[model samples]
Every structure is written in structure tokens, then in C-alpha cells.
Target: MTLVRDIREDDAQDWRRLWAGYNDFYEASVPTEVTEYTWRRLLDPTSSLIGRIAEIDARVVGFSVSVLHDSSWTSSPICYLEDLFVDPSLRSGGVGRALIQDLVDLGRARGWSRLYWHTQANNQRARRLYDAFVEADDFVRYRLTL
Candidate 1:
């Protein structure tokens, strides 16, 4: 059985391992400083970031990180699922689905206005999982890096 739960202080090492795998899969080379900062933010109570981990028989196998923020379009907060990854070996084993379902349950309980996320157009594997929840909107995303 897969168990999903909020991230804890002791999960740093396991989280880092999964995090590294996540970055590797995306071919992203996030700097060490930024990675450390993100870990700290996830553990900070006052931060808007929320982190959850998935464990199968006590071994961490996946994780999801989301951000909560007030939205101008709605009276309630919105949840943006920033990062989600399952161990490559454990893909298709229900961990990914469980993590997203956990977020959906959390959003419903918290009265979030919406929950959304995005991925590269070529990420068919992830798109398949995401599409199971909702159809993709016809929205284009642009970024400006300073």
C-alpha cells in the first residue's frame, strides 16, 4: 500500500534523492544554493509552499510540492502544483496518482478555488496522468527570467 503524508524534517535525505531524480528527468541543473533554499522553504511553517511525500512500505517513493496563493479571480486561495515526481522504478505503480489525489482531497477540504499545474508539451507520460484529472485548458504560458 502507498501512504501519502506531509513532509517532515527527517525526510530531507530521501527528499533530496527524489529531488535529484526529478531534476535529472527534466534535464534541469538547479544550483546547489537554490536546491537547499527550496528544501528550507518546504520545512518553514510560515512559507506558502507545501510538500508531501509518498511512501510504499516506509520507503519514500515520490513527492509533490505545491504553492498556495490568493487569486484575483476568486475569493479563495489557489493551489499550483509546482513539482511532482515518482521514482522512475515505481512509475505506473499508483504513487503518482495517489499524490495528486491527496492534493485534490486537500484542496477540497481547504476550499481552494482551483488546483492546476503544467508541464512540457512533450511530457506525454506526465500529461497522461494529469489529463486523467482534468482536460488541459487552452492557455499559453510565458516566462521572463531576470
Candidate 2:
């Protein structure tokens, strides 16, 4: 059974391992400074960033990081599920789905206006899991690094 819970201070090492795997999967080379900053923000009580851990039999198997933000389109806050990763060996074993469901349940309980996320078009495995929750919407995302 998978148990989903908030990230604790002692989870830093495991979280870092999973975080590196996540970056590798996306071919992202996030600098060390930024990673440390993100870690600090997640642990800051005043920050909107949140982190969650997924464990099975006391071993950390996956993790999710998100942020709550105000939206111009709604009165309540919205949650953007920024990062989610499971051990590659554990894919399709329900860990990912459980993480997402935990967020959905959290959003509802917190009265969030919406919960959303995006993934690469070619990620069919992830798409299949995501589609089980909701269909992909007709929106194109544009990013500009400044």
C-alpha cells in the first residue's frame, strides 16, 4: 500500500534523489543554486510551495511538488501540480495515480478553484494516466526565458 504524506525534514536525501531522476527524465539541467532555493522554499512555512512524499512499506517511492496561487479567473486559489515523479522502475504501479488523487482530494478539501498540470505530448504513459482523470484541454503553452 502506498502512503502519501507531506514532505518532512528528513526526506531531503530521498527527495533529492527523486528530484535528480525527474530532471534527468526531462533533460533539464537545473542549477544547484536553484535546486537548493527550491528546497528551502518548500520547507518555508510562509511559502506557497508544497511538497508531498509517496512511500510504500516505509520506503520513499515517489514525490510531488506544487504551489497554490491566486488566479485572475477565480475567487478561490488554484493549485498547479508542478512536479511529480515516481521511481522509473515503479511506473504503472499506481504510485503516480495515488499522488495525483491525493492532490485532488487536497484541492477539494482546501476549496481550490482548480487543479491542473501538463506533460510532453510524447509522454504516452503519463498521458494515459492523466487522461484517466481528465481529458487534455485545447490550450497551447508558451514559455519565454527572460
Best by TM-score: 2
Give one digit per residue, the lDDT tens place, for model 1 in 76-131.
99999999999999998899999999999999998998999999999998889989
Model 1 / residue 136 / CA error / Å: 0.6
The Cα error of candidate 1 at residue 119, in Å, is 0.8
Worst 10 residues of 1 by lDDT: 123-132
Highest lDDT: give the candidate number.
Answer: 2
- Scored by Cα lDDT, where does model 2 land? 0.96
- Clashing pairs for model 2 are none
- Model 1: pairs clashing at backbone N, Cα or C within 3 Å: none
Per-model C-alpha RMSD = 0.7, 0.6
Off by over 4 Å in 1: none
Q: Cα lDDT of all candidates, in order?
A: 0.96, 0.96
For residues 34-140, write the lDDT of model 2, one tens digit per residue. 99999998889889998999999999999999999999999999999999999998999999999999999999999999999999999999999999999999999
